[model samples]
Target chain A: MELAAERHGDMLLVRVAEPRIDAAIAIQFKEAMRELVADGAPRVVLDLAPVGFLDSSGLGAVVAVRKSIGPDRRLELAALTPAVARVFRLTRMDSIFTIHPATPGPEPTANRQAAPAAEASLPDGADEA
Target chain B: MKPEPVLAKRPAGAPRHPPDDPAAAGRAGAAGRGHGTTALQASRAPALQAPHCPDAGGRVPQTCSGTLRITLPATETGVRRGLAQVFAALRQGVLAGAVARDAAQGQAGAAEPVPQVPQSACDRIELVLAEALNNIVEHAFGPEPPAPATESRGVTAPGLIALDLSAGAAQLHCTIRDAGRPMPDGQAPAGRPQDIDAAADLPEGGFGWFLIRRLTLDLCYVREPGCNRLSFVIPLSAEDPPRPHGL
Candidate 1:
């Protein structure tokens, strides 16, 4: 449930500092994200680098967070750990969100087009995932 | 900021296992009575001998490859812990080594049926397990400690989930028993994926059963009086090259 937010230029980068986002913390996570994204930059990128696992409840929370962010602002996902990516892929939620690899270091205001992430083999230690 | 994970206080008859431990409670020994695996396990040698069960190694001795069982409270944390224990075994403990041995000694054990399974299947198994267990926690047990947790009604104590997984060469045969509310109409719901194209209002829920059905095969659910038993199978991943022993 540890989510750290940083202003990455025009975008806000919120790194999930926890190992998992499951049923146990789904509500809490959604509420926290609601607060964090309420008045941030026009774009919010959830860095799921530290997450080792995410279940259906967590998936729901992510979608709910998107809804709460409203239609005007953008909610993109970045650094999806293998497990997290798999959840999004299997559920086909990947189609909706603009996913990036490693928070897309260079481009913020320059490019709005979220190129599909090379999620097949992210170089994270989640080799196990 | 991570909010403190203190959920509603536990009832008087709360479980004794450490609270909200991702590892400790997940340390639920899932190796339940692997009957008849002792002799084969003994020959496989040293690493299998988990301290808890001397006669049998750290694995479920029921199958030549491996079988695992875990009994835990019907709580989110409990489910998380239970899943952790099984995968820990599958990756680092007896199950991994056994899978390795089965592949390495393929020529010799051609008679026995331990499919050449990939190591990655461990993750899928763990994922499906998390969903199934979480469903029981969120629905069956009804949001962990009930509202009147202080009532201390020994009559309606917290539920317990007993999950048994037998890792066959082809697929994983699983049986989960829980003392909780039965599935509506005593049937496993057909988890159909909703139209994601409706961009206006994205769905938040109903993905649990869909994932469970997607990742698993031949699912069946039965309610026996006071208990609910659900069983299913998950096909193993495409085979991979055999690794050296103790991988």
Candidate 2:
């Protein structure tokens, strides 16, 4: 699993370069994300446009990464391919994360501005235990 | 570690047919013909058999079902390879079905091309098969062996996974048999995906079976003797094309 991580202010944009995110690469994906966000970022956006297929194990790995980021930081998903998005929808994981239509780009302010109102409405520390 | 190959048989009462011999179609009785026409047969009878249509050169053009049967050790790489081969066979079967359908309508030599299984259906089958295969590779064979232990639980024991896929006009049927540990309570899990609270720790697992159940019809599982058999039917419909994005 190849992932390219770019830093935009306090947000990290990680793009999966693989067409598949199945059981074979699920663990590798989680480990890569953990390493990329080791220092922790205020927000992380996983760009899954290149991923044409995502199975349950891959979905779990994404969730595991989100939890590993802890409560202070948030993990969002962006640019999901139809097939990957379908998995998220079928599993109802879409409701749990802030999803963007496309990559928010280099400008962190643009992302904050484009963030959905529902995401903005989240209570402070709501994700914290 | 490679597990040994375990012989697998079709679930009790499932219609038995020769493996990939087009000539055997004539041997199948009328009842088998009905069973092979549509996935509806699976719903009506647990032992639904497949149709044994005549050869392509025969006078009557019928929807001839194709079957691919293979047994492999319960290893990750082996499962992956097996799935690839099975999917290829399924694609060929679908194409053959389309040709048979066209021939039945006297459109075999027409200028217009015969319709094939939609990309959506193929994608769904691939997804579902991946999940199923993964489950067998991970759980069925039991846990990995200790560092010094050369053989894993299933690797040393009678650990093998056999897959049989039958492709027809209305649906694709897959039968998976494994000589490994049975499901907890000897029954398939019926749990649905649980609601997640974002404020708490997000769930990292438990979605495999739910996806399988949602994507398939007439799903059934049986634990018989020393093996477990799981079979499911995936209906092919043009209306439900896979969306590339969003809900």
Q: Could you say which candidate leads in lDDT?
A: 1
TM-score per candidate, chains pooled: 0.72, 0.68
What's the residue-level lDDT of A113 in candidate 2? Answer: 35
- The sequence of per-residue lDDT tens digits that candidate 2 reaches over residues A1-129 is 688888888889987777677776789899999999886778998976556568898999999998898888999998665456667777778888888876777633433432343233222221111
Clash numbers, per candidate: 5, 3
Residue B77 CA error for candidate 1 (Å)? Answer: 0.4
In candidate 1, stretches whose alpha carbon ends up further than 4 angstroms from where it belongs are: A106-129, B1-20, B23-65, B96-106, B109-119, B146-158, B238-247
Interface residue Cα RMSD of candidate 1 after superposition: 6.2
Model 1 chain A TM-score equals 0.80
Clashing pairs in 2: A82-B244, A82-B245, B25-B52
User: How do the residues B126-202 of candidate 1 rate in per-residue lDDT, one tens digit apiece?
Assistant: 67888898888777878544422221211223466666665544567888877789888888888888668887799
